[model samples]
Target chain A: MNEWLLIFFMAAVTYLPRYLPFALAGKIRLPQTLERALDYVPIAVLTAIIAQASMIRQGELDFSLTNYHALAALAAFLVAIIWRNLLLTIVVGLVCFTALRLLV
Target chain B: MRSPLFMMGRCFPETYLMNYRTRQFWLGALETLPLILAAFPFGIVFGALANSNGLTFAITAGMSSMVFAGASQFIAITLLANGTALPVIVLTVFIINLRQMLYSANLMHHVAHWPRFVRAVLAFWLTDETFATVSDRINRHPEEPGLRWFYLGSALFMYSFWLFSTILGYTLGSQIPGLSDWGLDVAMIVALVGIVTPALKLRADWACAAVAFISSLLTFDWPQQSGLLFSSILAICVGMLLSRSGKTNE
Candidate 1:
C-alpha cells in the first residue's frame, strides 16, 4: 500500500477500537466475564511490549549473564515491585543497562 | 436512557459555576503538565528512530499527528522502515492496538450521549493517558456537569504536547548529538513501570503480573515477538482463574 493510504488505514483501524465501545455501550451490556477480562488488558499489553522490547536480542532469546538489558530490566522489575516507585525503578534500570553496555 | 442534551446539561449544571471552573483549570493543568514532560523524550526518541530508519520527517511527524498512538505507531515505523513485509507491519500494529477495543467498550457507555461530532473529536484523544485520567474522574464524579469539557481540556492538552514534542524531535533528530545514544529507548519501559506499578495493588493483580513476567521470560525467544502474546494470555487466564475461584468461595 502507498504510505499515505497505509497511514490512513492504520489510523482508521486504531480509532475504531477506541471509539466503538463508547458508541455502543448502553445498547448492550458487557458480560461479567468479559469485564473481568478487560481488567487484565493493560498489564497484558504492557507485559508484551516490555518483553519484546527488553528481553529478546537480535531475534533470539538471550537470558544469560551477558544480556545487560535483561539484567537491568530484571533489577528494575524487582525495584518496582519492592519500592513501588516508577521513576526510581526506570532510572536505576536504564542506568544499569547503559553502564553495562558501556563496560561490556 | 437520558437524552444527549439532558445528559450534557446535567453534567454541566448551572448552579456549580465556580466549582466547575476551578476544577476544569486544575484538571487541565494537572493533566497537561505531567504528560508534556513525559511525552518529550518519547517524541524525541520516536523522531530520531524514524529518521534513522529512513522515514521522511514529514511522514514521521504525520504519523505522530495522525496515528497519535505511541506504541503501535512506533512498531509500525520501526518494522516498516526495516523493510519488514507490509503484512507483518500491519499485523503488528493491529495487535499492539488491540487493547483499544476494551478501552472503547468501557468508555462508550459514559460518552454515549454526546453528539457525533463531539464523539469524533474525543475519539482522536482516546489515548491511554487521556482514558486513564478521564475515566478516573468520571468514576469519582459521575454526575458532575461539564464532564465532557473537562475531558476535552485534558485531551487537547496532551494532543498539543505530543504534537509539539514530535516536531521538536523530528527537527533535531540528526542535528542533536547523542540524543539517540542517551539510552532513551528505555523510556517506554520506564513509562510502563510508572503506569503499571500503581495497579499492582491487589493480590490477584500481583499474581497476574508475576505470572506474566515469568512466562514472558521463559518464552522470550518466540518468533515475531509472539512471546509477549503468549505471556499476556497466560497472565490473564491465571488472573481470571484466581478471581473466579475467590468468588466461588464467597
Candidate 2:
C-alpha cells in the first residue's frame, strides 16, 4: 500500500467504471428500467454531495444559523433558481455568506 | 479495431467533411468556458487545502492531473490528510464518482466505434463538465457533427486550467489565504446550480429536488457522511415511485 501503488490502484478502479460503459455501449442493450434509473443518477449524486458538503459539520449535524454553510447553500440554490446563471448564483451566495459571517 | 488516428477522425468527422460545421465547435467551446472559469477558484482552493492539510506540492499537482476529477479528488485528499482510513477515503471517492459511470454509458453511444487507444485517452478526460458541453451540443445538432474537436477543445481547456490553478494554489498556500474562507467553494456550487436548474423543467424533477433537499435536512446527523448518501437514496426512491405511479395512473 505504498503511495504510488495506492494512487494507481485507485485510478484504475475509478477509470474502469467510466471507461467500460462506453467501450461496450452499443454491443449491449440497456433495459428500459435501467435507462430510467440512469436519469435519476445525476440528481441523486448531486444531492449527496451537496448534503455532505453543506449539512455535516465536524462529524456532527448543525441545523442552526451557526451552520452558515447550509444557509449559504440554500440561498445560493434560491438565487440559482431565480437567475439561472452560474456566476451570479455563486457570487451572491458567497457574498451573503461572507457578510453573514462577519456581522454575526 | 480502428487505429487511434482513424478513431480520432470518427470522433471528429465534421472536421474531415467537406462542409465542416464550425458553429458546433464554437458553441461547444463557449458553453464550456463558463464552467472552466468557475472551476478555477475551486482548483485553487483544493490545492491550497491540500497544502494546508500537509500534502506536498507534488502530491497536490499529481492528484489534480492524475485523477482529473474535481470533487472526488478534493474529498479524497481532504479526508486522507485528516487521517481518515485509506479504505474509507477510497470508497468515499469511488461513490462520489459513481455518476461518471452514467456519463460513460451515455457517451458510449457516440464513441463506441472508437479504437481502444482512443477510448482510453478520451475516458481519462471525460468529466462532468466535458459531458455537459458535448452532450448538449450533440443533442442540439445531432447530424451536424464534429464531435471530436468539440470534446478535445472543451476537455483540453478544462484540463489545462485545473492543472494551472492547482499548481498556483500549491505554490501560494497560506500566502494567498482566505479565498476558501471567502466562500469560493460557492463558485463550484454555483456551477452545479447552473447545470441542475436548467434541467429542473419537469414536475418529477421538481419533486426529486424537493425530496433531495428535505431528506438532506432530515438525515443530516448521520455519521461518516452517510446521511448524504441516505438522502440521495431517499430522493431517488421518491422520484422513481412518483414516476411509476404517474405512469400507472395514465
Candidate 3:
C-alpha cells in the first residue's frame, strides 16, 4: 500500500507538468521569453543529464581516462558531430565503453 | 475478444491498409525503434535494481505503469532504497519531470486543434523518447495531418517496450549480479547526445550546452540532484538571454 501510494504521488507529480501545458497552452499564447526558454530545454536538460551520468562516479567527479563513461561520451560526442547519426553514435559509444572497461 | 490486427481492421474498415494515419503511426514507431532498443537494457536495470533495493515486484511494475518516466523511476528506486521521505522523493521526481513541461509547451502549437481532453491523454503518454522522435517529424512537416497517430504510435511502442524490459530485468537480473553497475545507462546518454548534438546548430544552443555541462559538473554533489535542476535553469536562462540579444538573433 505504501508503495502504491508512492507510485500514485509520482504519477501525479509527473503528470501535472506534462498535463498542465497541454491543458493550458493551446488556448493562449505564452510570452516570448518562455518560448525561448522552452527552445533551450533540449540542450540544457540533456547536457546536464549527460554531465552527471558520464562524469560523476561513486559520488565524485571523474575526469580520468579510467572513467569509461566520460571517455565513451567523448567518442560518442565526436561521432555525433561528424556523422550526426544517433544509431551510429550509440553503437560507437557502447563499443568504446565496453572495450575500455575490458581492456583498461 | 479478438487479436489487435482484427481490432485495427475493425477500427479502419474502409481503408485498413491504405490509411495515412496507419502509415504515419508505423513510421513514427519505426523512427523510435533505435532509441527504444538502446533503452531496453536499462529497463531491466530498473527492475533488477528495484528488486535488489528491496522493492516488491508490484511496486516496481506499478511505478513503470503509473509514473512511466525513466530517469525519475530510477531515482525513485534509489531514494526508496535509502529510505528517503515520500514527499522528498516525490518532489525530486517532480523537479526532474519539469522538463516535460518544456516538451509539451514546445509541441503545443502543433496540436492546438486537438481537444483539451485528448491532449491530456497525449500528455499522459508524452515522454523523452516519444517527444524526441515525433518532434523531428512535426518540425519538418508542421502542416502534416494525422501526426497525433504518429505520436501515439511512438508513445505506445516505447511504453510497452519499457514495461516488458522492466519485468524481464527483474526476473533475469537476480541471476546476474552487478548488472546495474555494468553501465548500461550509458546507452541512454549516448542516445540523448545523438539527439541533442544535431539540434545544437545555433550559437545560443551551443552556449546552453556548455553552461549546462560545466555548471552540472560543478554542482554534481549537491543533495538529491538539485544541481541538475539549477544547471538546466541557469543554462536555459543564459541561452535565452543570448538569443534575445539583437546581435545573436540568428
Candidate 4:
C-alpha cells in the first residue's frame, strides 16, 4: 500500500469514533450502564498501552532482567506516585532508563 | 429527545453570564502547560523514532497533524517498520484510539448543546491531555459558560506544541545523530503515568488497570498487536462487571 494512502486511512479510522459520539451527543442519551462502562475506558486503555510498550517486544513477552523498558517503567511509576508531577516523573524515568541501559 | 436546555442538569446551573472566554482560555492553556511540556520529549522522541523507522519527513509529520495521537502513531510506525500490512496497521491504530470514544462521551453532556462544527473541531482536538485538563476544569466549574473556549485553549496548545516539536525533532534527528537511541520514548510512558495515577481514586479504576496490565502481559504475543485490543476489551468488561455487581462506585 502507498504510504500516503495508509496514513489517510489511519487518520479516517482514528477520527470516526472520536467524532461520532460527540456528533450524536445531544441526539441520544446513553444508558446508565453504558455510561458507567465508558468511565473505565481511560484507565483500561492507558494501562494496556503501557503494558504493551514496557513488557512486549517484537511480538513476544520479555519480562526478563534485560527488559530495560519494564524496569524503567517501574521506576517511572514509582516516581509518578512519589512526586505526583508529570515532568519530574519523565525526567526521572529518562535518566533512570538511560542509566539502566548503560548498566544492562 | 427532550431539549437538554430544559433539563435540570447535574452540572451546576449558569449562575453568572460573565463574558470571560479569553480569561478561561488562557487559564485552561496555562493549567495544561505542564502536560504540554511533559508531552514535548515524547513528541521529539516520536519524530526521531519515526524517521529512524524509514518514514519520510512528510509522512512522519503528517501523521502528527492528521492522526494527532501519540501512542497510536508510535504503534503505527513500529508496525510499518515491521512490514505489517496496511489494513492491520489501520485497524490497530483505530483500536488503540478507541479510548477517545470515552473522552467524547464524557464531554458529550457538557458540550451537547454546541453547534455541529464546533463539536467537530473540539472532538478532533480531544486527547488524553486535553481530556484530563478539560475534564478537571468542567468538574470544578460545571456552570462556567466559557468551558468550551477553555477546552479549545488547552487542546490547541498541546496540538501546536506536538506539531512543532515533531518537526523540530525530525529536522534535527539526522544532523544530530543518535537522537533516536537516547531512550527518550520512556518519557511518554512517564507522562502517561502522571496523567493516569490521579484517576485511580476508585476501586473499579484500579481493578480495570490491573486487569489490563496482566492481560497485556499474557496476550502480548498476539499477531499484529491485536493483544492490545483484547486486553482493553477484557479490562473494560472487568470494570463493567465490577460496576454492575455494585462492588465499586460507578
Interface Cα RMSD in Å, per prediction: 2.7, 2.6, 1.3, 2.2
* Model 2 per-residue lDDT tens digits across residues B9-111: 5777765553443444544555687778878888888888888888777777777788888878877876777777777777777775666876786676677
Indicate whether candidate 3 or candidate 4 has the larger lDDT: 3
Categorize the docking of model 3. medium
Point to the candidate with the largest DockQ. 3
True contacts recovered per prediction: 0.50, 0.46, 0.86, 0.75
lDDT of 1 by residue, A1-104 (tens): 36777688778878877777766766677788777776776666566566666666766677779867667777787887787665577677777877888888
lDDT of 4 by residue, B1-250 (tens): 3322223222335512434786567667776777788678788888888877778899988899998998788888888899988998998888777778767887778888899999988888888889878876665577878788888889889999999999988877777878866656566676777667766776677889999999988887786566777888789889878767766443
Model 3 agreement with the true structure over B1-250: per-residue lDDT tens digits? 3533455567767546667888778767777887898889989999899989888888888899899999899989888888999999999999888888888888877788888777888899888889888777765677888888889889999999999999999997789999887788888888888888888887888999999999999999887678988999999999988877837335
DockQ of model 1 vs. true complex: 0.41
Error of 4 at B73 (Å): 3.1
User: lDDT per prediction?
Assistant: 0.71, 0.72, 0.86, 0.79
Off by over 4 Å in 1: A62-104, B1-22, B25-36, B84-88, B113-115, B132-150, B177-181, B218-227, B248-250
Q: TM-score chain B for all models.
A: 0.77, 0.78, 0.87, 0.79
TM-score of 1: 0.77
Model 4: runs farther than 4 Å from truth?
Answer: A57-60, A64-68, A98-104, B1-19, B50-56, B78-88, B138-145, B244-250
Which residue pairs overlap in candidate 4's backbone? none
Instruction: State the weakest 10-residue window (summed lDDT) of model 2 chain B.
Output: B18-27
Q: Once model 1 is optimally superposed onto the true structure by TM-score, how far is the C-alpha of residue B56 displaced, in angstroms?
A: 2.8
- Proportion of native contacts in model 2? 0.46
